[model samples]
Target: MLVGIPLDQSNNTVKPKECASEMSAYIVEVAETRCKRSFAKVFNYFAPRLRSYALKQMGNEALAMELVQDTMSNVWQKAHLFNAEKGSPSTWIFTIARNIRFDMLRKLQNRKEDVCSDDLWPILCEQTADANEASLDQQVTLEQIGYMFESLPVKQKAVIEAIYIDGKSQQEVADELTIPLGTVKSRTRLALQRLKGMLHDND
Candidate 1:
């Protein structure tokens, strides 16, 4: 009962109850050689469904569209990995979509946790100190820390600020900075290391 848009020999689109195996075979063709028509057929059939699925999960039209685009791009790239014997084409594509959605959700959760994290400023005051002394120590320590942070390399400083101060996930920072996630992580790590060295030298 699966209704699909199938292209006939005349290049006419027809609604047919196509078997999943046939669709999978077409994907195999796409894998072996780049076939624009075959891919178009697959895109026509699956893109809207993937979009709807993403919309329901993400609840944002723009993000859902992005999800669909990313999922389809993955499909095109990984077409060779699709095995009909292991799973149907629909199952494989939906699995990719599911994984993408899960990753997005995980990143969103990370951003939320980062927003609430206390790691932005180290606890520098002794608990044994009086309240007034602790307050003054904290103020001085925070000022020094801020100065050190500002001294970091521009890219490193930007990464740390986005992640820790702005509560943005690494992915968000990457997108904002037009850099890769690995770059964001590397800059943050290097920034922290340099900041630690500066603090140690001062002490």
Candidate 2:
């Protein structure tokens, strides 16, 4: 029988449990005995990558950083429940982040649909913007979009067109771009970032 010493700063005693209790007990002990160091080590290992993932998902740097911090905080609070038999710490942490993001997105009820209809409207239609100014603004918007398109890296431009203009599914864009699905996802995300910047600049 192996006698495990408590190492964590917060809980310097063994936790009683049946199967795989030793590993759980070890983590709990380490955390209780060395709470600061344990949390620091875990944060260092996961924060940067998790922050980048959150930024890609949220499209906002400050919010992304908040999400990452929230994730790490949860990991610290829930560390006692971690089971090596189920998954590694990295996997467990990422799963928590993913769930948090999903919950956040679900709660955001103000989502706007991005798809546009390309069908031409009849000229004998309801009056919208003033004809002359609307025509000028439309021309300016097109010119601005064209300039922004030219500024994008080729891969980013292609992904934007496939999704916004050609109406491709993300999977289809991944296949056509010959990039891994995750790469495709990230590139598309950054492409939207660029577009937002460009549009804001024009405005």
Candidate 3:
């Protein structure tokens, strides 16, 4: 079922640029008044592209469709959080879609892991190292890494996230970002070098 109220557009033939402008305006309306017609317009425009994005990530048609639905639901609920000054509507919507896909994958992984069995086996093993100490070290390391990540330039950060966090190949990242493959590689290398330097400093 479509989640937003439908708007009448029987006589309108919106050009691409006009449609983008309209979407931005509609998002603002949705934020200000929870306008269903505006939300519907945004959903109608973005839902198909979002579905294709999900399909590429998970390769499942049903799951992809579900992701699109959930992403739109998020847009409806969190419209107020969107700021046009920070990014475009497409970027905001695609970021939501990416996060939802990540959540779905994480949930699937959690379901596959039998926590009880995992805990039992770990307890049964001979404990040579201190698990608590190791865990604390890992937590600290992750926190430092996150800080380092935030320090990278926007383009470098985006390249690293696409290649590593989002698990996309260099070519895929380049294609998605509309950059050359060589630029993607160079950014990834530079980002990694900086991160490694930060890590080494911590050590």
lDDT of each: 0.75, 0.66, 0.78
lDDT by residue (1-203, candidate 2, tens digit) is 31343333332232323313443444465456745554554565467779889999999988799889878777777676566677555566667787677656655655553321111321122345444643332234687788888899998888888989999998998887678889888988998898887777665
Local distance difference test, candidate 3: 0.78
Write the residue-wise lDDT of candidate 1 on 11-47 in tens digits. 2244433547667877898899977667776777788
Q: Please estimate how well model 2 matches the true structure, expressed as its whole-model Cα lDDT.
A: 0.66
Predicted structure with the largest TM-score when compared to the true one: 3
lDDT of 3 by residue, 3-52 (tens): 45564553146666667667788899998999887787887778877888
- Which should have the higher TM-score, number 2 or number 3? 3
Candidate 2: list runs displaced more than 4 Å: 1-34, 110-203
Once model 1 is optimally superposed onto the true structure by TM-score, how far is the C-alpha of residue 110 displaced, in angstroms? 3.1
Lowest-lDDT window of 10 residues in candidate 2? 115-124
